[model samples]
Structure formats: structure tokens, C-alpha cells
Target: MIQLHEQGAYYFDDQIYLESEKKNDAWFDPEAGKKKTMAYKIMQAHNHSGNDRILELKFDSIASHDITFVGIIQTAKASGIEKFPIPYVLTNCHNSLCAVGGTINADDHFFGLSAAKKYGGTFVPPHVAVIHQYMREMMAGGGKMILGSDSHTRYGALGTMAIGEGGGELVKQLLNKTYDTHYPEIVGVHLTGKPKPGVGPQDVALSIIGKVFANGFVKNRVMEFIGPGIANLSVEFRNGIDVMTTETTCLSSIWATDTQVQDYLTTHCRGNDYKELKPENGAYYDRFITVDLDQMECMIALPFHPSNVFSIRELNENLEDILHETEVRGQALLEGSDVTFTLTDKIRNGRLFAEQGSIAGCAGGTYDNICAAANILSGKSVGNEEFSLSVYPASMPVYQCLMDNGSASALMTAGAIFKTAFCGPCFGGGDTPANNTLSIRHTTRNFIHREGSKPQDGQLSSVALMDARSIAASAVNHGLITAATELLQEEKAIPKYFFNKEIYENRVFQAHDQIQKDLPLRIGPNIAEWPEFNALTDDMLLKVTAVLKDPVTTTDELIPSGDTSSYRSNPIKLSEFTLSRKDPHYVPRAKAIREVELERLAGHDVRQTDEGLAAVYGSIQNHFPDFEYDKAIVGSVIYANKPGDGSAREQAASCQKVLGGYANIAKEYATKRYRSNLINWGILPLITPDEIELKNGDYILLRGVRKSLEEGSNRFEAYLVNEDLQKINLGMEALTADEIQILLAGCLINFNKKEVLV
Candidate 1:
């Protein structure tokens, strides 16, 4: 259903051509030609760089959820930020379950409100709305740019260029600094033909994700949606697809806006924010993805990743073969673990079954998606046979409209429980499935342990992603895996949505331009100050604490989300859980290295603490005669094939930093946000050759590490200080000037502190 063009393409008259007839024409100016793209216009408008190759962006507004906002505010406050320079929205959605951490979640919420009041920002109370939903309703504007702390922060359907990044990026905006980067390549996503009735937006999204994610076709690039098929989908339908683009690892996304988009903003009472956005006739793209929406089928992304997609029809046809392959893959993924992962047990009578069904979060909990789901389950019931269904509307406004229009009643009557607006399930905080069970969800992701199944504790479950329509279809069949098209009936007529703005008026606190200086932040006992970080020394000796051979390691496995989110405000406490899910030994290993650094700082003899390290220091001295063991900072490092796949949570990198991590050596980083998190935390995002072999406990002595960074040397020479100290090459890829300064000063906060002092 989706075709990827490997070469540069041109879009004309709503069609994509890999090589246009007008190519190489004397009249065409490649520099001026780029202006035809909608991304170029939006980015140029926000760009502060005099050169088009570099981008220094200042977003119109910024957003954060409860799990992130507190840390962001703390960093910004420490950096001497007095007030928010731009609109900042803090939504208490992720940490809505205040009881998880014993008043810590609520304390973070109170701190968010107090900070909003003290620093001229906006705060949405718990369950009022999910972060992206609130931004869509009130903050998103046509051609505007928004930076959010959560990864799925995509508002492309509304013609807004929204980027989900690490919390440090948002802190830069709070401090009136710019988000610096090289100009991202633009990829044209040309949609053609109408989607089949049962094929919802998630199906289309998964098809696209399955095509692009594995090859990194659209990674760190802007996905500009343009095509005649854009007119065939509703704004809500477009939104459901757009929000999931984060899974593609794209930097940001934007779409051509039509009357449908105009009407969406108008209905939400923000008509003035609407503006028509379309690519110029001869717009050029670095690459192109042509999606035949008509060919899309009820899709399911099997356990572990959103990109492991297959059509429901194909999967059902080859059930045994597919399940067996998945089981083998699961075995490899969960190798050396205590838990026994199995999916074949779920199959009975040649059909698969799921224990739970969820249609919630930004990608699934839209008014149209829920409305369509309610229609499908109008008279049918989700029979109580170990199968349950729950629906969470995107926002209070959507909830009110669903209730008023009888959609809520239809779902409730069909035994599907209705819930308030919350983002807990999407990140493993709520509605976790029973051990060894399978869940079908319409949420954003289905990564391992993301459903709150602690595999370390012998509790392992799996989640498969599907469209809400298919999820409801499966629910009605009592969790028997079924496609929505199998029992197709007359399409339901969706009522015109009437947005109730009063829901926000009474609940949300808008503190913009109303800064209260005397407001004290309600800090809980769990909330702690950031640990002091030391500046980069002349030389460094980093011991590899953990080595991950996984193809891609997600953030969930790094610091974990779910219940651990409640401890995000406390760096030291949260660091204890770093890599706890993936490698249970990583924390203790990292802590041992941290203790060594502490001992060195206290002027203790290194040989007294760890006798093995004394030999490695002697080996390093043999290579560099001038090298001083006492001057070299001792820290920990981790090597992975490719790390930082999912989530924009800064704690993934910060936790490592808290445990005295100095660098991360990887073949490549999975996402820009993850790499940026490492940079912001003053950890070197080192790039190594794919074939390089390094093991845990191997020490690498980086000579002139600080000097190399300050001098803009991309490559550095290091020796593996083992029994045989051999030379190894290490390098960093594409660090901005600010990033270099951040590293030199230890971290973004320290970098900003030095700036303020200067």
C-alpha cells in the first residue's frame, strides 16, 4: 500500500515523480526552488540562521506533560529563567494517578500549577486533557511551530509544524534561547485514493511506519503531506494518522490545510488560527512516500514495535506461521530473562484472542474515532469472557460531545467502560493487562513492558496496535482477533462535533501574563534538587558498564516509564532504575563506577578502591607518557548497536548522567531527541564503527577529550586500556555550537549558568 522513492522527487499537481521532465532545466534554481515546499516556508519563517543549511528555531509555543514539566521548569529555573518567553502549556496527564508514588504525582501537579502562576504559563489540571489535545484545541496555529516535551507531539493535520523533543529543548525556549539544528530534509508523503471503510487512520499510519521505520527513510526529516487524497479524509482522520508519525522517527511533520482543517479550528473556536497551507506546484522533496489509501487493510503491529506491522487479513490467513515467527523473535528479545514469553497460547481454533482492548490517547481517542467505534459496537456487547474494553476520550470537550451525542451511551451499553481524558494507558501507567495475556490497543505504541508487565518479575504481556474500529470489532467478538471489514455494515453517520469550551474555562488555569512572584512551589519529599555535575576534564577514562547488542533499544528500557514516571523529578532516585528493565545489572555497575569517581574526587588512591583499574591506568600511561592518572575523570559508558528509539523523555539520558556516565558509544542513535538528551546531559554521544567490538568492563582512555571537543575535532583517538591497550577511533556526529558549550560546561543547565554569570 506504500511505496518509497529512494531518490529525490518532485511533486506536481498532487502527484510525485522520481525524476521530472523539468529536472536539469536551465531555468530551475535549486536554492530558490526549495521555497515551493511548505516546510521551507514554515522553517524559514522561524529560522534565525542567515544560512539555509543551519536552523535556529524559536517556536511559537511550547508544551509539557506532568512527568516532564517539573524537570523542565527546574532546569530552566536553575538557569535563571524568570518568566516564560513564549506560551508554555503544562498538562497533568501522564502523572494523573497521584496515588502511584504516594503524593509525589500530585505534588508534581501542584508544582506545575504554582510554576505556571509564578512564571506566566498555562496549566491544565489532571484529566482535563492530554497534552497534545490541549495544544491542538488552544495552541496550534496554521504555519506555527510548537516544541513539546513528549514524543508524540505531532499536530501536522492542522498545518502546524510540531516537534516532540527532550525537556532540555523546552528549557532553552523558557530561557529565550533557540533550538539549533541543521536544516532537516523534507520528505513528501503523497497520499492517493480513499481508504477502505474498515481501514482507519492507524492502518494507514502503520503501513507508512512499516515501510519507513526499518530503513530510516524519513528519520530526522520533515514529513510534508501533500496529495489529492488529503481531501478524502476528515481532519480527525488526518489527526489520527499524523500523531503516530513520531514512530517514524521524523523530526517534525506538516500538512496542506484545506477547508476541513479550517472548519476544525473554527469548530474549536479558533478560526483565526486557521490558514491555508499547501506546497507550491513544483515543490521538490528529498524522498517521497506514496500511500495508496484504498489498498490499506485492517492492520496490526505485533508485539514489541509499531513497525512490526501486518495486515489483519494476511495474519489470519497465515496465523500459525506468523505466530511461530513472532514467538521465535520474542525468544531472542527476552533471552537470558526469567520470564517465558509466548503468543501461541493465545491461539485457539485457528483464531487469536486478546485479553484487553483500549481505544485511547492522542492517536485513538479522537471524537470521530471513538464515535465510529461506538457505532460499530452499538448493539453488540463485548462478552465478559476474560475480555474487557475501555475507551478514553482525548479531552473533556470530546468527552462532553460524545456524551451529548449518544456515542458514549452506545459504547457503555455495549459493555465498553468509558473513562475520563488521561494518557496513562499509552505509557504503561493504567489498564495494564494480566500476565501472559495479549492486548489490542489503538494507542501510540506497543513496546515491550510498555503495558506495565514487569518481565523481570516474571510478568510478561504483549500489546498489538490496531485501529479503534478494528479494536472495537475485536471487542464485540469477545477478543477473537477479527478485522473490522469482516463484519462490515452500513457506515455510521458521525454527528457534527460541538466543542464545549466551558470544560477548560472552569478547570484549566491560564496564568499567562499573570506572574505571581510569591507563589511557593508545592514540593513533595520525593522532589529533589539536581545533582552537581563537574565540567569536562582535560582527559577521561570511561569504563564500559553495559553493552547492549539489541538492534534498537527504546527509552522505556532505558529508564522505563509507567510507575517510574512519578520519580522523574528526583534525578538520583530515578537513576537507580536506569536500564533496570533491560539490564538489571546496569545500575549496580554504573553505581560502582560512580563510587570510584567519588573516591577519586575525595583524593583517595584509585588502586585502593579497585585494583583492576590500577592496571588499566598504568596501561593508559604507557601510551601517553604525559597522561596523569589523577587528572583523568573516571566515569562510565554504555555501548549499544542503536540506542534511544522511543520517547522524548530526557531521563533516559539524564539517569545515565546521574550515575556518572560520560559517554554513549553506539553505531547510531535511533532518534534526534534521544541524541539531544545525551548532549543536554553532558554525555558524549560517540559514534563508533558498526564492526567495532567492545565489551563490558573494558576501559577506554580518551586523550585530550575536553580539548578535542572545544577545538571542534569530530574524531578522537582512544586506547582500550585492557591487558592489551589497543587504539580505537571514536567520534561525535553533528553537534551544534551550543551543544559543544553544553558539554564543556557539564550540561545545559551548567552551560546556561555560566552564560548568566558572564
Candidate 2:
């Protein structure tokens, strides 16, 4: 169903060609070779770097959710930002549940309102819209580029190139600095054929994710949508699939715009933002992914990742073998933990059973997805047999549309609970299931502990990703894990979506033209300022605090979401939960090392704090006789196979920085945003070999660390100062000039502060 082109190809006359028929054709223009791509055109329009290969981009607008905007605004304010240089939208979605931290969530909302008034930005009230949905309804424009703090910020289906990145990048935009990066490769996602009646956008998305994620086929590249299949899908259908592109590890996505896109914009009252967007007839692509939509079936991604995909029919046919494999994998994922997971117990009789089903968030809560789900469950009911269902619309307008069209009533009549616009379910803040229960959801992620179950508390539940159609099908079958195609019912006609623009007009606080600089931000007792960070010294001493063997570590594991999101506005408070889910002992160990640094800073003898640390310093002194204890920086580090997988949350790195972390050693990073988060926080992203043996508490001392970075040296030599004090080699793969300065200045905020003072 999916074919991957291993090499570069060209698209001409609506067809892909690996080689041109005539090499000497006069139509081939060398000057336009790089400009033929739709991504290139859009990026060129926004590029301020002057060079085409390396992009210093300035976005048209930027967005942040409640869990992120507070930190972003704080960072910008610290960096001397007076007013927002571009349009900024602050939406309260992730932290809308004010009951979690005793008035903290509402305090964050009020802070957002005050910041918007002071900075001349826009603020969406709680439950008005999810970040991406609000951007789609109000901000997305043809050929425009937007950056968001949430990872699922993709609106390519609307002909806009949207990227989800770290809060540091947003702070740069707020400071009127450029987002620097090398031009990304473009991968062509050529679509053909039409989807079957029961198949939904999630089916197509999961199918593509399964084929590309493991192999890194589209990692850090742009996926440009093209071909005849583009016309077969509606704008909402395209959006459902587009938003899930974040799962494929692609940098961003874009689509060829036509009447369908223009109609979508016009219907949402953004007709002026519409523009024709398409690749030139002959455009080059680094790779091509051809998906035959006709062959798509109801797909389900097993627990732990969106890439672990299998057809619903295939899973039902081979329940025992598949379930056994998943159980074994889950056990290994929770290796040192006290939780025991079992998928076999969920099997009853001959069918696989799930305890819960959900259709919510940016991926599942669209107007068409809910309408189709309601149609499937129109007359059928989800029986009270230990299986329950819930649905959350993406925005107030969508909720109002569902209410007007009776979809909400139909879903409620079928024993499914209807909720307002919220993003809690997607990130585990709401509808968390019982221990060891299996939930089938259409949310963006299914990573470990993503369902809000705390394995540390002996509470472990799992989630499997599925389309809304199949989820409704499973609900109707009493959660027997049924596929939508098994019913063979006629397709129901869906009513046209009517957007209630007044909902946002009356409720949202737009501070664009009404800046109230004197407005005082209401602060809660739980909120706190960022802790002080030490700058990089000429020499460095790093202690390995924890070594993770997981193949891919997600941001959810690094700094958990859900109930812990209430503390995000307070950096010091949030840092306490760093690695709490994955490694509970990480914080105390890092703090212990931090105390040693504090002792050295206070002019105390380093040998008196800890005997083991003194011995390591003595071993380091043996290499350099003139090495002074006061000149060396003492901090902690961690080693992971590949970190930063799931969300674009900056806390993944900031929390580490707050705990006196100096570096992260890895074979490779999972996403660009994660690595950027580390760089922004002044944490060295060291690239290490896969087979290097380093354990927790092993001290590594680097001589002339700051000088090498300042001199633009990529490779650095260090010594392992444990009992087996040996020489080791480390390298910084690609550090931009600004990134080097950021690390040297301690962080982006410090760097910007120095610049402002000058």
C-alpha cells in the first residue's frame, strides 16, 4: 500500500520520474532547480537569511498553549523583550484544568491575559480552542509559515507551512531574532486512489507512520503533499492526516493548494489569506512516498508508540502472538519499575477487549471525524459492560456545530460521554483509565505513561491508537476491538460545517489594538521564578548521574505531562519532577552533585564534601598539575540511546538545566526540537558512539572545554576520572555560531541579556 523511493526523484506533468527522458531538454532551468518545490517557495517568502541553503526564517505568526506560553513569556521578558514583534496567540488548552494545583492553572490564564495586554498579543480563554485548531480557524494562510510551541502544530493541509518547536525559538522570534537552521530536505508524499468507505484519515496516517518512523525516512525533512489523491480528500480529512505528520518525525509539512483549500479558508472567513500554492511542474525531491489510499484499512498502533502499527483485521486474526509480543516489550520498557503489565488478560473468549475508547484532541476531534463517528453509532449503543467511551471536540465552534447537527446528542444516546473543547485527554490530564486497563484512543501519542497512569504509584494503563471510525465500532461492539469495515453499513451523509465565529469574538481577549501596559499580572503562590544558572567555565567536570538504555526516550518521560503540567509555569517547582517517571532517583543524585559545585563556589575544600568526588578530582589533577578546583565546573550528565521523541515541550531540557545538568551524551537525538531545547538551555549535546560503556556516577573531566568551543573545534578529548581513569573522545556534531555563543553565555536568555546591555 506504501512504496518508498530510496533515491531522489522529480515530479513533472503530475508524475514522478527517477530519471529524465531527455537529459539535454531545453525546458530544464538550472536557476530554478531549488526554487521548484512548494516548501522552497513558502520558505523563500519568509527567509531573511539571504542565503537559500541556510535559512534564517522569520515566521508570520507564533502560538503557544497554557503549558508553554508562561515559560516562553518569562524567557522573553528576561531577554529584554518590550513588545511582541509578531502576532502571538496564547491559548489555554493543556493546563485548563484549574483543579489540579489549587488555582495555579487559572493563575496561568490570568498571567497570559496580562502578558497579552502588556505585549500586544492575543489570548484565547480556557476551552475556547486547542492551539492548533485556533490557528487553523483564524491564523493559517496560504504559503505562510508559522511556529508553535506544541508538537502537533501542523496545518499543511491549509497550504500553510507550520512547525512545532521549542519555547526558546519562540523567544527568539519575540526578540526579533531569526530562527537559524540549514535548509531541510523535501520528501514527496505522493497520494493516489481514494479511501474506502470505512477507512478514515487516521488509517492513512498510521499506515504512513508505520512505514517511515523506524527507518527515519522522513526525519528532519519536509513532507510535501502532491498528486491526484490530494483532490480525493476534503480539507478536514487532509487536516486529520496532516496533524499526525509529527509522528513521522518530519520537520514540517506542506500541500498543493487548490479550490478545496481556498474553500476551507473562505468558509472560515479567511478568504484573503488564500493563495495558489503548488510545486513547479519539474521539482526535485530527496525521497518519495507513494501511498495508495484504496488499499488502506482500519489501522491500530499498539501501545508505547504511534509507529507500532498493525491493521485492525490482522491484529484480530493474530491476537495471541501480537499480544504476547506487546506484553514482552512492555515489560522491558518498565524494567526497573515496580509495575507489571499484561495484555493477555484483556483477551476474553475469542475477541480482544479494551476498557476504554476516546476520540479527542487535534487529530480526532475535528468536525468530520466526530460526524462520521456519530453516524456509525447512531442506532447502536455502547453497552455498560466494563467498556466506556468519551468524545472531546477540538474547539467551541466545532462543539457548537456538532450540537447544531445533533451529533453530540446521537453520541450521548449511544452511551458515549460528550465533553467540551479541551486537550487534556491527548496528554493524559483527563479521562485516565484504571490500572492495567487498555484504552483505545485517537489522540496524537500513545507513549508509555501518556495515558496519565503513574507506574511509580503501581498504576499503569496503556493506550493504543486507532481512527475514530474503528473506535466507535469497538464501542458499539462493547469494546471487542472490532473494525469499522466489519459492519458493512451504508455511508451516512454528513452535514456541512457552520463555524460560529461569534463564540471566539465574544469570549477571546484580543490585545492587538488594546495594549494595557499597566495591567498587573495575577500571581499565584505556586508560581515561582527560574533558578540561577552558572556559565560555562574554561574547564569542566561532569558526573554521569543516570544512564538510560531505552531505544527512544520521549519528552513525556523526561518531564511528564498531565497533572504535573500545573507546575510548568514555575521552573523551580517543575524541575523537581524531572525524570520522576523514568528515573525517580535522578533529581536527588543531580542535586548531590550540585551541592558539591556550591561547596567549591563557597571556597570550601572540595575534598571535604564527598570522598568519592575528592578522589575523582585528585585523578583529574594527576593529568593537569595546574588545574584549580575553583576554575572547574562540576555538574551532572546523562547518557541515552536516543532522547527527545514525543512532545516539543522545552521542560525536557530546562528541567535538566535547573538541576545542574551540563551535558547529554547520546548516539543521536530523536527530534530537532529536543536538541534545540538542550542548546537553548546551554546543555552540551555530545554525540557519542553506540558501544561506549559509561555508567552512572562515573566522573568525566574535560580540560579546556570552553576554549575549544570558542575556537570552533568540533572534537574534544576528556578523561574518565573514576578508578579506571581513561581517555575518552567526544564531539559536537553541528553547532551554529549562535548556538556556541548561547552555550558560552550559559543560555539564550543570558546571551540576549549581554547583547541588550551592549
Candidate 3:
């Protein structure tokens, strides 16, 4: 059970909390109490801004996976980055499979190693560890800040405030610039009572996510975990819950660190980096959440989202009803598509089944999760039917520990396959299910087509997020949907974990400030430089290319994942897949708009391409006598209710930019990282009225957009182009000074190319 308190609250030490406004005046100071939070202390320590209202932060370290590094390095290189100023870790985890058409995946890995050496960073070889796991074991320290290109870069359980952001942010760090933002609201997550047996960390996390995600209670706020529950969970258990915070759309998360955290760091041979971190007495929280772990159930997030949750017991009781509801909701997402998304059919003879089971990635691949699965499936078998199970330890060290403890052999012998450390299963690079099947995983997300189902090709499948304990329980029953509570007997004692640092030392490449300035970067055939982008012009004319009426449009739907990720190194090639899943016509429509811009830039565009545009220009001239047709920049825009959920890949916005996208008009952005990505790619993030009507091919002229931004006006005037001009107001909210400059310069690369440092 989870309870939310949006009204500000104050906590005395870690155990007791009282409403801030209702608290006694004996010792109440909102400002002083605000400084007592663990998140505030860590952020201010990393803050370059002298004042508390604004933050110009430089992280202790940064990280990127293979799918992101090539573009990040190219952008940083184009922006005049001499060397990495911090301990940058480049891990080859996401694109580990060299199974794409050519050698692009392997090529990117080589490029990462070269960049690590040339820029004085670190590189973890493919199958060595995931980006987050490596950071947790090797780099994370108490009170340290880490910024990563991947969205699940949360190490809060270990006293580190790590944030996963777009690649542009890392490029800023590489160029010695700061990550700018204002002070964020801190939400206190008070955990009391220990988790019951068979209730894994994912169960507790889903309980909280189910309660908070829909209401947006904790969105964009830092979740600060405190209370007596801190001492009950292991470091890895806390990590399993912490990583899923990304799904709640929270900015970042941190938990009160204890001896367990100290032991975790000490075992990883970074004991000196451990600093005791706890919320000081009378800490103030803008929002407070209490999670009763004892009431947790074996939870399941049904297909299409991580928030569409239900207890396994509840699903079993209402079997057809729950599945039917999910099928109906999922069908809505695929309404115009050829494939029929169904989940009700997965119910076989009153028993639900999953075709596949996976326990991997930063959340599920921990030693604790893997051991729990092994214990549940100790003497049982997943069977030799269509059902299959696979396990991937987060790191080679975790894998070694699993092997040492005999869990790997036990599960493998029980008919589950054991794989090397890789993030493929988590993001659709490996273990993809057959068409129309369902995969129950302990991975971070369950977005549509995330399981590698190509709906466009008449293939469709879905993923249900569950704990490793429940996944193993279901696996032992030959994929019968069963909670761990039904099959789990007495809890077995887990073996002591021995951190194997030598595995990384031997396999990973570490650049101890030995920068190779003269070494040429290995340019692979698949890797390509970004095309030129123009800075913001005087005014802009935007044609609505795609209108997504979906409740939320995710990054995966924006640019897609899986095989398309093979082209991530080449911006032009990758752009071809923009909105391919959500809107098949978006690319061609956006490209047509881009062609007009290309013609205008050539000084030959005079209504020759399309006569309708000439008429719109005449109308614009009637409204403003000084209106110049050639001066207005032509680009495409997309409207969504809420966009930018799931994944911190910059390609979601960058792909749109490469295809001549100039703006994103949304009622509200789903995450701060997504909006930042849009700005970093030189796309305007506009907040429009919820009832504002927009259709594909409708044109809108933004009058003096550049001048308005220069004048620091949040509201911009635009005219909807039709037979008659209709006025509309667009809002750009809370943009920082640094963000405005990036937009004006067209993008972070172009902005940084001028060597402007903040």
C-alpha cells in the first residue's frame, strides 16, 4: 500500500513525519529544513551556482552505452571538446549483439574503446557489464553525482544521486559545461515495515508506481527515501526498486544510506568513497509518500506500459476481465495498424501463461534477484514446451558470484538458459518472443513493441513486468502465470557475495588520464557525421506533420529501438525510422516540409514547390505588411497530449530534427529529460491549450518567434493558416538561460561550437 501527501511535510529524523503547515512552530524552518534532505545536500555540493534557487551542476562522472556513445562523441568532438574532464565510462551493453546487417555494432564498440583512450575515459567491453551496474560497482560513491545517457542511471540506493539524461547533456560535460536547472521539489518516500516473504523489490516498486504514475504526483521531483525500512532491504533490493523510479517519471531518486550501503561500497573496494548519508532532523519535503512494504503482492504490469499494474492474485481471480480490459486498451494503441494486439487469448484453459521469462538488466540482473529466482526454481523445471527462461547477471562479477553460489547451474539445469551480461533482453536486442506471445520479465520496461515485435510486419507481442521470484514461479509451472507466494516455501538463505574487481580490471579498458591527443578516431563505414542544422530564424512556418492523440507517446515509438538502434551512429540513416511505429506517414510528410526549407535556403523557393504555401504567405503579408516569405523558416511539428515517456535516448527528438522538425506542441511533456532532448536538438518545446485543435497538414505561422524568445517572452503569438487567419497562443515554460541559447544556436552542438561556456 502507498499513501501520498502532496501538502508539504516535515520529518523529525528518519522515523517520524508531520505536515509542515500544521507542525508546531517550536522548531520549524522550511528553508533550513529543506537543506537537511539528502538530495538537497548532494545537489548543492555538486552545484556550481552560488545561490540555492538555481543549479549549474557538474557531475562527478558520466556514462553512455554503445547505442549512444558514437553520437555523443561526434557531437562533443564537433563542439571542440579537448578531453574528458571527469571519469567518463563508455559501456557496450545495449548494442552488444553484432548480429545486425553489417559490423556496425562491433564497430561502435571499437569506437567507444578508442574514444575512452583518446579522451582519457573508461570502457567496459561488451558482455562485461551494463552501464548502470558498472557505475554502481566501480564509480558510484556517497554524495557523488553521475549523469548518464541512459534513463535508468539511478544509483540513489548507494548514496549517489545519478541522473539519466540525453546524450547532449553528456556532450556538455565533455565540453566542460554545466547541466543547468532550477531547484527541484523533493518528495520523501517513507518506507516502513519489511517486505513479506516472496514479495520482491519489484513488487514493492510496482505498488508505488501503480499508485503514483497516473496522478503525476511525483513527476519531475527527486524521490528521497527515508524511514525505518532503510535497514530492512539489501543494497541490491533497494537498487531494484530505485531503477524503476524512472517509470514513475521522477527526475531522480536517493535512499538513506546505511551499513548495508557501506558494506556494498567496501566490498566493491571503494570503502573510502562511502560517506554516511541520512536526512537530518526536521527535514522538509514538498511531497511525502509512505510505502507499506508488508502489504506488497506479487505484482504484474500488463502489456504496453509499466504502470498498467495488477496483482497476480487479482488477475487470477478476475482472469478474463483483467485480460479483456488490457486487450481493449492495447487495441486502442494499434487501432490504425494492421496487427491486432491481444492479451485475452494468453489465458489458456483458465490459466495464464507467458511464452518467455527474463530476469536481466540493471534492475533484475542483480545477484539478489538471480538468487531468488534460482531458489524458487531450485528443484522445479520450466519444462520443454514453448515456455523458456533466461537469466543475465548485471555484471560479470555478479555472474561469477552466481556461478560460485551454484544458482546459475541450478537454473540452467532446471531448463533455463544462462546468458552473459548484456542489456539486449531488456531493450529487444535478444530473447525476443514469437509473434502474438507474451513475455513476463523482471526488466525495467514493458512498452509496446519493446519485446521486438514488429507490428508493422503483422507481428505483435507484449511484455508483462514481474519480479524474478514470480517469473521463476511461473517458469516452474511451465509458464503458468503464478505468483511466487503460491510456490515459494521457506525462504532460503542467500550466499555471501564476493565482489570480483579483477574481472573488470582484466576485461575493461581504463584510461588513467592518459589522453592520446594524436590518435585518430576510427571512423567506421556505418558511422556518419550529422548533417548541418540552421540556427533559429527571425520567424517560422510550421506544418503539422503528425498528430498523436494517444494519451502518451513514448521515446520508443518516437524513434523505435531494437534493430533500428543499429543505425544510431548515423543520424541520417537513423532519422528514416522516426515515428515509423506511431505514424507511418510522418517521415515522408516531414521530408516534404524539409525539401521546402532546402529550396528556401537555396534562394529559389518562390511558390514553385507548392502554390498553397504562396497563398498562405499572401495571407501572412496581409496581416503584417513587412512579412517576408523567404525569411520564414519552414519546418514540421507534431502534437501530442503527453510525450517523452520511457528511455532517455536523444534520438526521440534528434530524429525529428534531422527530418526538419522545428517544434513539438504538447499539452504537457511526460518527462524533463524528453523536453531537454527537444531543446538540445534545437526543437521548440511548446505548451499549448489542452483543447487546441491541430490536424496533419495544417500550417501555422509563428510571428517573430525569435524576437519573442530574445525578449524573454514565455507566450508566443502564432496564426493558424486557413482561408482566414485564426490567432493562437503557444507557451514555452520555465526555460533556463542556457537552454534558450541552445535553441537559438539550432542545437547543443552548434551552440557549443561557438565555445560559449556557462
* Per-candidate RMSD, Å: 1.1, 1.4, 1.3
Q: Which is the winner by lDDT between candidate 2 and candidate 3? A: 3
Error of 1 at 273 (Å): 0.3
How far off is model 3, as Cα RMSD?
1.3
List runs of model 3 lying over 4 Å from the truth.
Answer: 20-22, 756-758
TM-score of candidate 2 to 2 decimals? 0.98
TM-score of 3: 0.99
Off by over 4 Å in 2: 20-31
Q: Which tens-of-lDDT digit does each residue in 173-210 have in candidate 1? A: 88888999999999999988998777799999998999
lDDT of 3 by residue, 694-739 (tens): 8999998898788888888898888798878898878888788888
Ten contiguous residues minimizing lDDT sum, candidate 3: 13-22
Query: Which pairs clash in model 3?
Result: none
Q: Give per-candidate clash totals.
A: 0, 0, 0
Task: Give every collision pair in model 1.
Answer: none
